[model samples]
Target: MISQDVGTRAISVQNVTKQFGFFNALSNISLDVAPGRFVSLLGPSGCGKTTLMRIIAGLDRQSTGRVVIAGKDLSLTPPHRRPVGLVFQRYALFPHMTVSQNVGFALSLQRVEKKKAANRIGELLEMVQLSAFADRPIDQLSGGQAQRVALARALAAGPPVLLLDEPMSALDLKLRQAMQLELRQLQRSIGATFLFVTHDQDEAMVMSDEIVLMNSGTIVQRGSPEEVYRQPRTLFSAKFLGEANIFTGSLRREGNKSLLQSDVVNVRFDVLGARDTGAGLVCVRPESITIEGASKEMFVGTEPNSVAGQVREAIFQGAFRRYLVQVGEQSIMVQQPVLAGTGDAFSQGDQVLLKWSDQAVAQIEDDTNG
Candidate 1:
């Protein structure tokens, strides 16, 4: 069992629901983010990720449920009263204020002493590596610099939990990647719990300790990046996380082996006992399927699992070659290292063998909800 710390609960959402007219933005969502842990709510648009974040920050109230932060029930806490810091996607810094003044804005609002606020501003600037730009106006800073200033301003109030709502989405690809690492390091240095929301799967996988995947006003799955990638509990999760080829097939058991019978292919595999129960969908990552050499094919028997495919298109992708192959009526994608083998250079119609390990196939539920 996972034990909760006795001191405080960082953030808890119990049976939360939110609606807008006839549309349900969020439906009975419950999640707990551990103290000092980085958790990300990840999903596509209209999945209610932003709605949940707004509720936590007190920017929007839930129709029904409880929000507890640091062991305090936030029933009446407004946005300003809650011990939370929010950094928005558009750096919302004051144009008229200098970097130092912006960072000290929260302290000034609370009637903190001038000398103490100055020291706090200096500390925050140093923390976000913006100490040298303290005197510069907000308009003069670059996108990354502006984001750092916004972060500094958010932390000025010494909030225990920080909420980032697509904070790096405005930057370019390279800058966004760099900022993800920097933000993760900053979170560790500050020792504060971070609840981040983003639609980018790569961003969530790169920065989060745990990820909550939502779709259609419900949470599809939640787990570590590796766990979700390796053994996805649902077909939606498997397809959403990365490239996967999903095939529906009937299952039959004989002795200790399981056979998946499809319309175009019949593959025999060995799975844990549950897979042998009935029909299900099989998910295979493109990288897991391989092209065999002439010598390798001699040792292995050609039957159910192995299928003949014709290369429909081959695109060179610098690091790898992506091949779109047609096997009967189904199209399967396979990727290989650019520098590997040359027995039969495949063209638009060249026949190739598609082989995969039985262990690579994962059984997912065939229901629409998955």
Candidate 2:
């Protein structure tokens, strides 16, 4: 029964729930996609991201609630009748059809004039940089070329919204990274609202204007990539979004700053409004930790945010050095940049101190703990 009559919405999903018998696939999902914005539905497998995307495309019906598109209630609308284009993981281009025919498939179905369709197809092929291969059969193109053809076909009709489901998963690593940049640039140039679905965190962070992270049939969190990454609201959001070093401890307040008291080490985590006593969790990102050789005057019990640990392993990555340190029962990871010819990298069995500002770590809210 939830609805949004605020700004113009390209896609409005209101209190939509989907169930297969007793198993709920999506529970009370409600989301708004503004017109001509690129948003991504990101989550792990079986997180209902795909199911929700299908509901928006009219391929699956919700058990309850409504869907409105561009001021029209399209809950009962069929898939082909909706003004949305779709692209799948596989290219799904016709084996017997040439690039031109495949790109112009929707246009031909609408019975647009022959010369006009060819001209429009030519423009799309040029846009995707596949004009040279327009006359070639689908079987003759490379994997990247085939993907470009599929993208051009989806954009051929100029649909107001485009739904993509892991469209770059099939490509190799280098190609996938390249396509990520290209697709983001293409979305900006064409000005079409894109609702993308993917499991890769890097891909979602790179291209999305806003990311909707779903978990176990519910929306866990939704915000810009930096907001969700830097200030995670929940423990699940902190761990699932990126690599996190978790600390289970107690929370206390000291004047303007909050402190996370743990058995391993105590740090000043500036959290707010929670009880000053109880078990809690503190999350520190790997890149935020700074590792240095421990001096004689190391941190005592009263240091603000510092700890001493023994280096268990140190690996040399190209641009940075990765160190694994053991402090009591916790394993801390620190990534330090390799300055040119400094030779200051630590090795195994070396004692190091972990130091970071209070702004680097956060106290995560844990509602799952009973």
Candidate 3:
């Protein structure tokens, strides 16, 4: 991990809006990335993550707002004049060039000395662990190797900021997973600010120092992966980053606590204030709920944080057992870790009680219509 100074920003985007015809691709988006930090622009496809990256890279101009890269305002600068490197999804490498030639293309454009360019290419190939295949043609390399070549080419100019737009989407699952770690390590070692754009939640979680979640060209939430996952502020943020079981009801105040009453489930949790006292929605993660066998007598007057439900479906995934329990009119998903050499704990058609702590449930806004 790279330590970052919050006092300084490597890339600052202020109130940027990109308009195409009448369709607003990005709407008043603003972001600040610290030096040596890895930030991910995470969202679904067509959510304007790519448009934001293009605007930062100067490939597409923002309709309004300023773009400052490495402390210089470059809103109207051309792509080549910006102090940022770009890695596209398709790589766009020269098929006729070798790995060394591709990695040194930017250096050659600057008219650097031949020996200096060769040394820089050697260093980059070694950094990406492709020194052994430096002479291989672009078409002869594997998907992972090609991606590394593109990364090396992007970093050839030693730009202060690097913009990667789904550079690993073409690789297989296993290779992509492996490269996620590799790319993270590369960013840490190089200490350059990286802005990665991906729709993959897992990818963003594994690699980013911070996650900026966007929806409909607007930022939904921005925080660390664990913070966003554990404390989502809205329904979209809750459901998009991970699986969540939402409980909705009318909210009422009880001293310093808040109680949500519903026919299906009632939740009583501590609240910081009275701002949220109307329509209440709470999100609980599947792994946070515990399941145990229960009888009809145990569910007479249901208590807060406890619910009795029948197991409708039980799946034996390798690492955990996923159970879909039918409670009232809703079905809640619960995951239990599968201990090695232990048999299944609960089977289908069994009665079970699910319980979770109030701290495990996050209060989220009902932004379904937003």
Best by TM-score: 3
| Backbone collisions counted per model | 0, 0, 0
Mind giving the per-residue lDDT tens digits that candidate 2 earns over 1-370?
3244723799998899999999999999999999888899999999999999999999999999788877688898999999899999997999999999999999999999999999999999998889999899999998888989999999988899999999999899999999999899999999999999999999999999999999889998899999888877788888888888887777778887878777778878665564556777878888899887886456434576789888999999899888999887789888888898776789898888898888887777774554
> Candidates' TM-scores?
0.90, 0.95, 0.96
Encode model 3's per-residue lDDT on 82-159: one tens digit a residue: 988999999999999999999999999999999999999999999999999999988899999999999999999999
Per-prediction RMSD in angstroms? 3.3, 1.9, 3.1
Per lDDT, what order, best first? 3, 2, 1
Find the 10 residues in a row with the least total lDDT in model 2.
Answer: 1-10
| Cα displacement (Å) at residue 183, model 2 | 0.3
Q: How should the candidates be ordered by TM-score, best one leading?
A: 3, 2, 1
Off by over 4 Å in 3: 1-7, 341-343
User: Using alpha carbons, what is the TM-score of model 1?
Assistant: 0.90
lDDT (CA) per prediction: 0.85, 0.87, 0.91
User: Residue 240 in model 3: shift from native, Å?
Assistant: 0.5
Looking at model 3, report the run of 10 residues with the lowest lDDT sum.
1-10
